[model samples]
Each structure stands twice: as structure tokens, then as C-alpha cells.
Target: MTQATNDQFLLAARPVGMPKDSDWQRATPALAELADGEVRVKILYISLDPAMRGWMNDARSYVRPVAIGEVMRAGGVGVVVESKSPKFAVGAHVMGVMGVQRYWQGPAEDKGAMLAQVDPAIAPLPAWLNALGMPGMTAYFGLIEVGQPKAGETVVVSGAAGAVGMTVGQVAKHLGCRVVGIAGGEDKCRFVVEELGFDACIDYKAGPVHAGLKQHCPQGVDVYFDNVGGEILDAVLTRINMKARIVICGAISQYNATEAVKGPANYLALLVNRARMEGMLVTDYAARYPEGVATLARWMKEGSFKNREHIVEGFETFPSTLNMLFKGENLGKLVLKVADA
Candidate 1:
């Protein structure tokens, strides 16, 4: 790859299904000089999330979609190399929607709405982007606020070994719930139970998720933190307890589908069991991020929580590395190391 002054990926065209290389164009754009209350950051690590897939489409969502000819939107952690803002000083490490770029220049308040200073001393930079960042916030709020599992209740989560799911199962266990995870393979299922401390994990690859859930959860599911919607969601619906709370986090399984997202066939199960399934977008809980990060950070210090990140080296690898999430090649949160922090 040729060296550029400042590298960035811009959407060249809206993708039809899975994004292709042709969908984006890499450019070396010149940086703008900062304005008052503005700061410039050198991006260190860029977060690779399943949600980025939805952002590629020009659709109205909880947040505005990434537009054609615009920098592909992403969350990242960086250091304020230049600052004209009272909120942040030069050398301060910050995390925000910095997009897929080598450098970001903007008003502090504009980026800081979903941003916070990251202390590398407390946790490594990558860990911040993993457990203490957006993924952690999503799992924390989605499970605690939306799923609402109680002690002795059975909590089931799909995508149970990915970034959000890994945290959800651990949090539910900490709250005294019987936690069961649904993962794609034996290795992932094993990792969830043996490493992340879930009570049980059903291997969706081994058999039908409904059958596995029956064997694992003997008691009906009280809360379901759903990350991968599709057949797994419909399977979970079959065994929900009355008043079960379903936290709709993401649907990675259907992100690349050429057709519309698959609606749960057993949705009447929500009606039958009087359960409620509510969608969750992490940014809505931004106000409480400090509270979530503080507790999650403490849990990490005490070793009650585990954080995993599959670090793909090089900023140039974004185009190919992103497909890892859809292919289930990444174990936990997928992150791209853009440069040294």
C-alpha cells in the first residue's frame, strides 16, 4: 500500500448486501485547521462492530446512516494531539465516533457526546475499546435495563461468545441468574462456559438451538439477550417464560442478507407468554456510561469479568478484516490497530 498523509475510507456507493471493496474508496484527505473549542486526534484503535454494517445502508436508524462520499463511521480511541478546547487538553486520551481514519479534527462537544477520556493506566488501550468501551456499555445496559433478569431466573443470550454476548452472560451470572449461552460452535460454547463462566452453552452447530435450549435451560428462559437474530431468535421464543424480557441488541446473522431481516416466526410466543422484545442502541445509554464503565472497570480489577479482543494489525486491513465478524472468525470484540498509541 502506498503511504498517504492522512488515510481514510469513504463510502463510494451504498452496498446492496455485504460491503465490497468497490463500495469504498481510500483517500489521503488534507486535515482542516481546528476552530475554537475544537481538538484534533490521532486515532490509535478503531472498533469493528456488527452495527457498522447497518450504518453502511442509507436508512433512517437510531443514528444517521453513513452517507456516500463520507468517511465510513466508526468508534475509536485516540490522543488529542492538538486542542483549542477547554473540555480536553493536548495529550489527553479520548474515545468517540472518530470514524475509520488516521486523524480526526472536530469540535470537542460534537465528538464527546458519545466520548470519554480513556485512562491507559487503568486498562490497556485495546481493553478500553473492548470491555470498557461501547461493547461493554451495550452489554451492560442491554442486559441490566432491557433483559432484567432476576436471581434464580434463567437468562439466555444468543451470540453468546461475541463482544456483547460474552459480557451479557457474565453480568447475568453476577446477578445470580442461571445463564445459558447459545454459540455457533463447540469451541465457542466451551469458551463461554469454561472461560467466561456461563452455567451452560448450547452449540447451535451441534443441533437445533431449541433442542439445545431445552436440554440446557430445563427452566423456561426468563430473559433473552439476543444479538444474532434469525432462527436463533425464533428458537429462543419457543421456551420463554411468561413476562420474559427480550433485549434485541443486534442481528449479525442477517446483516448480509439480500432480503429483508428475518422476522421471528414464533413472535406470537411474545403474545402467548406475555413477553416483550425491545431493541437496544447503545448510544441511548451514553449518559450512564461512566457508571457502567466504573463498575465494569472494577469488575476487571477484581477479575470477575474477562475481556477478549481479536486485534487485526494494520489500518489497511479494515476492508478484509471487517468480514471476520460476519464469518465468525473473531472470538470477541474485533478491533483494528490503526497505529501505536
Candidate 2:
């Protein structure tokens, strides 16, 4: 039996550097009676990403910041307990902007915008938010469209063992590129190379990243998919081949900086080598998502892609669990389990 009252974390304050407990206000919002075209959902899992940290700030970006007094924005998976829409069936699995709450109610008119039903039969519920979801889609467009990877080329990915990084490396591998992954720990490095089939894995916490790139890609990097910004981006810039492609995805490293975000000092390498660097937003590829999802799903079916998740229990642990992303405490995707399905 689910609770009658809904638990949620609202944006209380704009975080300065790293978010603190004071940044959020927990509350119980009353569940409303179902209206026509609306569906009530019982949230099971919530995605905790480095991007969420950025959303806490008032800075201008791709989307509007989560306003103070509003429900903290989050992506989640849930079961539709009640449906007043012909579009969605009761008991159907759905994923969307379900927020940091145990329950969510939205309309069918908002499907594919705020809510969309997903098929659990295709993959596990978590995979819909991981390999088969945003992370996979981000990698597909960022690497293939922006990075333009070619066979036999040496491709490098910062945060390689992460959800988006893992997918980018594997997809580049599938395209016949030699893939190098930059991660934090030896365990993450080992798993990416041994299990995810990356050609090399660099432990950024161990030493300077340039040395790792030099050792792993002596021929020079061809396509660099950057997830962490700052120094790592500078390091990769210094090693790019002529006409090389660099794709800017997310920058987890600079998300919590008190100072202004730093641009790569070695950006001049782009001019010297005639290389190109471009930024991308996942939403920009919305129309082609079906094409991308189908391709990733097929690869998953073939055992070439690894679907990994780091799940933390308890919806009440949202604040602490979210901080895990910045500390590199989580391997692969970070998900908060709100409740049992």
C-alpha cells in the first residue's frame, strides 16, 4: 500500500559550491484526485547525475534553473498506478521528469515532454535511465554526430567508466576506433578495459592525464569525447591530430567550482593541428532519439554494451546520494531507489 501523502525535495536555496542540506526543503504534498488525461505514478528510481548539480545554480544554460520553492527537477522511472488517459494503460512502466518524489501525477498531453511510458520488457527499468536512456542517447549524438569517429582512429573519453563515457567508448569501439578511458580509480579503469573492452584506461587520480594519453595513444588522439572539463580538456587538446574532432559533453569536474569555469589553456592546439571542438546538448537530438535508441538496444542484445548502475536506497537520502556523483564515489550511472515497485 503506497502512502497517501507524497514526499518531495524542493529547491530551497541556490548552492554555492557543493550543495548542502540547507539547499533543499523536504515536504509532503497532498496527492490530488485523478483528472481526465492525467496519470498518477509511483516512482521507483531517480537518476542522480553531475548535471543536477549544475541545475542547482542560477547560471544560464540549456534550461531554466530549478526555481526556489519548486520541486527539485529529476529524471525517474515509475509504475502508473492509476490512469485517466487512453494513451497510457494502468500498470505501464514510465520514465520522465518525475522529480525527487515517491509519487508523480501528470497529463498524457505532457508525454514525451514530462512523461512517457517505457517498455520494461526491452530492458530492466534501470537501463531505461542508463544505457538505453539519456546517457546512451547523449553518447550517440555527441560521439557520432559531433566527434565524427573513424575506424582505426584513436578515440579517448574522459570519465570513460561513467554512464555516458562508458557508452561513448563502446560505441566508438563498435565503429572500429581504439578507445582509451580516463577514470578515477584503478578498479573503474580495470572494469572499463577488461569488461567494457576499452583499449586503455587512465586513472586521472593517479597522475597527470597528458602522460596517460601519451603512453596509451603515442600516435596522437583522433577523436576526444570530453565529459570532465578543466585540466583534462587542456591535456587532450595538446595531443590532438590534424583535423581531430573534440566533442564537449558534460563537465562534472567544473560543476562545483566556486570560481568561474576555466577554458582549456591549450586550446591553441586546435589552430596548430587544424582540429575542431564543438559543444552539444542531448535535447538537440530529440527528433532522432528513436534511431539512436534502436541502435543501442540492438547492440545491447548482442552483448557488446555494458549496462552498469550504482543504486542507493532510500528516497530520504537524496541529498547525500546526489553528492556521490561529484566525489566519484559511484561507478557508472548513479540511481536513487525511491521505493519497491
Candidate 3:
């Protein structure tokens, strides 16, 4: 097969506050020839996650910052167009941290970043990277490992309609825990309770979150899976039950903060309740991803799990699609369709 150059979104400058169009540079570069054990893939759907914003800044974090002039970092689903790897064949659909680009070339040995073949029959390409993908694993491990909700316990989740939060709520419900969701709007709150099977939902935008939490979780919260940190976190911290567990997931509220991150003032509740608060990185549970995916996919097929995708039409919509997370405009897992299947 003939190799052709591809266009990619490059980081032109570090972003201050929220990123702007001027911070990115769109450039075309000649595709490198496929080397031994390497494969070339044509990217189809790119995952637009809140964590992508944190990755743009050169800060101390779980992952390295995207280098200046490099392709904007992203987790994407793609189809192999060229292959020298024995494990992967041409036409195979795969998912990986392939960045925001049309094509990718990498070695099979580099499993850390190289694309992994995805079974499109089990779930759609986009779902593999969203529901049954990184976000799904995050919700699973974060709740089970960090939150440790016992059956009949009250599980409260922030960012309830989002990819991770949605899954966390549903999984907790399936485990016999009474789930309470906190979302940005009444519509999202209704969807979380009615569709995702949460026992109750609170619209953080409608009124006081602390009151809503009190109304829904009369028994008090046993597990708090926090996604949006800030005021909501502070409110939840005050409602923790004795020996409650708090799972510190992504803090979307503070991601674009120009000011210093504000810690919850109600954190003393942990000491009073003998509770534990732990932050989790999903990558730490990478060894058990297949196990999590299998269980999630089975639940999906059995009608116990639901997966939602907020798909943007084109690659050009990437920038605006990313901003939707901060604005709470996206309903579920946000994805940009870079190419047709």
C-alpha cells in the first residue's frame, strides 16, 4: 500500500484559562514508512475527555504534557491500513492513545501507546474507547476499589450524566447500592435517575446541592464518587456517613481554573466519621482492563448497562466539542467522528 501524508492538530502554545483556537496549529506532515513490527492506522473517532485539558499544561501530573508542535494528545479508535506486526492485520479496528490525527504509525511492542485491536462486534468502535474503554474502567475500579460500596449502601456520584459518572451510578445500582446522582441540569438529573437507574438525582444548577443531597440520601452517603470537585465536593463531604469512602476521580470543575485549586473545607468530616478519601488513576488498574470490559459489555448486552455517546460530526468540531465539557453541554461520552467506518 502507498503511504500518504496526513493532517494533524498541533499544540501551538500553552493555554491560559480555557484554550482558544490560537493555541492550536493545524499542520500536514509526510507519513513515515512503516517499520518492522509497526502498523499504520487511519483514525476514525477521537475521544474528547476533560483530562485532555489538564494534559495541555506542563504541570506535575500522571502523564506528560503534549509537546509544542506535536499532535494534540487524544485516545482514538482507528482501522489499520498498513501492518508489519504479526498480532494485528490490515483492516483491524483498534483503540489507543494515538493522538488527534488522521493516521498513526507505531510498533506493536510499544503497548503503552500502540493501538490494541478492538472487537467491533462486541461494541461499536467509539463505545470501545468510551463506555467499555478508559472511562468505563475508571468508573469500575474507582467505585469498587476506592469507594468500596457495600450492598444497600448509599452511593453518591458527581457528573452523573457523564461517561464515568454515568457508569459509576449504574454499576453501584446493579450492586444493590442506592445511587444518588448530582448533575448540572434537571434534564440530566432526570436522565441519570430514570435512564441510568439511579435511586435519585440532584440538579446542582437548580438549587442548593446540600439540600438535595439531604433529601435524596436521608441515610447519609456511604460512598462519594466525586468527579466535579469544588463546592459540590465540599457539600458532599459534609454529608458522609460513619466509615464512608470517597473516591477522588477527575475534577472537571477545577481543570480550567486560573486560580489555585480549592480544597473542600468540610474535609474534617473524614476524621469525624473515620472515613477514607483516596484519589485513583485508572491506568494503575490497566492489568485488569479486560476483566472490567468483559463484565461491562455483558451488562450492556443484558440491558443492565447503558452507553451514551455525544458524537460531534467532524474533525473540525474537535475544539468546540472539547469546550462542551466545561459548559456541561455534552450529555454523555463526548467523541469527535474523524472519519466514517
Candidate 4:
């Protein structure tokens, strides 16, 4: 193959609030020759996630901060355009932390690379970034392992229209639980209930979450999957039944907050209810990804599960497109299309 160029977004500066264009710098660098056990992947679709906002802060977290001038950390699906590794063929499609770049050239075994081949035949390329990727894995393990909802119980998910939240609610329904979702708009709430088959969806933008929870969950909540933290989590806390399980999956509401993150004030409710609130990271269940993917895939094949993705065309829209998440502009999974597969 001929020499290639890689266009990328680098972390220029950390943001105090919501990220802006000034926080990122774009560059087109010439790709280096692949070494032994190395591969060059042409990124197709980049997964725009709420966790990315936390990754930008110059603070301690599960993953290291994206250093200045380094490619912005992002998970994406791509095709191996060039390869020197026997594990990957040049035409194979793959997914990993390929960064906010047009091309990714690195060692196949690089810890930072986290490369894995994905088959478009199993699901659409964009679906891999949404329901079948990290978000799906998060929903599966967080709900199943942490929340542990049984049949006849009630499961409530905040950010219910989002990638992870949508999956959580649907999976809970499949397990014979009553699923309710809390989202920002009537359209989103309608999508979760009408399109996604959620038992009910509370439009937090329309009214108070506490009231919605009280009305829909008269029996109280047996399991709560929290994607947006702050008031929603607090509201859910007040309605939790005895031995309730709360899975803290994310805090998208607090991701772009200028002030320190607000925690739930209803902590005493947990004590009074004998409930447990636990946090989960999808990476911890990396070893069992195949298991999770297979189960989610089966549901999709059976038409019992559905995935919705709001894809934005153009790599240039990275900054603004990502802001769509915090603003609740996108209906489902927010994805950035870099190139066609």
C-alpha cells in the first residue's frame, strides 16, 4: 500500500465546564510504516460517549487523562487497511480505542490499542458502537450483575433514551420485570415506551422526576439503573423498595458541570430501605465480553431488542457533536461517522 496521512483531534486544553472547540486542536500527520505485529486501521465510526468528558479532566480516574497534543481518547470501529500481524487481515473490520483519528497505526498487542476485530455481518457497523459495544456491555453487566432484577420486580433507568439506558430498560423487560425510564423530553420518553417497549417513561423535562416515579412506581423500585446522576438518582432513591439495588452506571448530568458533582441527598433512604448502591465499569468485565455480546446479539436477532443511533456525518463535527449528549439533542446513541465501511 502507499503512504497515508492521519487526521486527528488532540486534547489542546482541559475545560472547566462543557468542552469547546478551543479545547481541541486538529492535525494531519503522516502515518509511519507498520512494524512487526502492527496494523493500520482506517477509522469508520467513532463512539461519542459521556465518559469522554471525564477523560479530558486533568485529574485521577479509571483511565489516564489524554495528554496535550495526544490524539483524543475514543472508541471506534474501523477496517484494517494495512497489517503486518497474522492475527489481523488487511480487510478485516475492527474496533477499539482507535482515538479521534482518521487512521490508527499501532502494535496489535499494544495495551493502549485494545484492538478487536468486529464482524459487520453480525450487526451493522454503527450498531457495534452502540448496543453491541461498550454501552451494551455496560447495560448487560451493570443490570444483571449489579442490579440483579428478578421477574415481577420494577426496574427504573435514568437517561432511559440513551445507548446504555435504552438497553438496560429493554433487558429488564426481557427478564419479566416492569421497566420504567426517565428521560429529558416527551419524544425521548415516547421512543423508549412506544418504540423500545418500556413499561413507562418519565419526561423529566416535562415534570418533576419524583412525582413521575411515585405515579409509575406505586409498588416502589426494586432496581434502579442510573446513567445521569444528581436529582434523578436522588429521586429514584426515595422510591426504592427494601433490599433495592442501584447500579451507578454513569453521571452524564455532572460530566459538564462547572461545580463539584452533586451526590444523592437521600442516602438515609438506602439505610432505611436496606438497599445497596454500587458503581460498575464495563472494562472490569472485559474477559466476558463475548458472553455479553452473544446474549445481546441473540436478542437483536430475535427482534426482542432494538438499537437506535443518532449518527452525525463529518469528522469535523467532533466537538459540537459530542456536546449533543450533554444537551440531550440526540435521541439515542450519539455516533460520529468518519468514513463508510
For TM-score, the strongest prediction is: 4
lDDT of each: 0.89, 0.90, 0.90, 0.93
- Report the lDDT tens digits of candidate 2 across residue range 1-341: 54678999999999988899999999998888888999888999998877898778887988888899988888999998988999788899988987898888878667444677788878899998887788888999899999999899999999988899999999999999999999999999998999999999999999999999999998899999999999999999989999999998988999989998998999999999999999999889989988988898888888988789989999999999999988898888999998888
Candidate 1 per-residue lDDT over residues 1-341, each given as its tens digit:
21236799998998887788899899898777789988888899999999999999878887888888999999899988888999899889998888999988888889433557889988888888787988889999999998888899999988888889899998898899999999888889899999999999998888998898899889889999989999999999999999999999999999999998899999999898999999988888978988999998899899999998889999988988998999888888899999886
- For candidate 3, lDDT tens digit of each residue in 208-279? 999999999999999999999999999999999999999999889998889999889899999999999999
Which candidate tops lDDT?
4
Model 1 residue 146 lDDT score: 86
Better-scoring candidate (TM-score), 3 or 4: 4
Instruction: List the candidate 2 regions with Cα displacement exceeding 4 Å.
Output: 111-113
User: In angstroms, how far off is 129's CA in candidate 1?
Assistant: 2.0
Ranking of predictions according to lDDT: 4, 3, 2, 1
Q: Cα deviation of 300 in candidate 4 (Å)?
A: 0.7
Candidate 2 least-lDDT 10 residues: 108-117
The C-alpha TM-scores of every prediction are: 0.96, 0.98, 0.98, 0.98
Error at 134, model 1, angstroms: 1.3
Candidate 4 lDDT over 1-341, as tens digits, reads 65477899999999889898999999999888889999999999999999999999999999999898889999999999989999899899999999999999889887987999898889999999988999999999999999999999999999999999999999999999999999998899999999999999999999999999999998999999999999999989989999999999899999988987998999889999999999999999999999999998999999999999999999999999999999999999999999987
- How many clashing residue pairs appear in each of the predictions shown? 0, 0, 0, 0
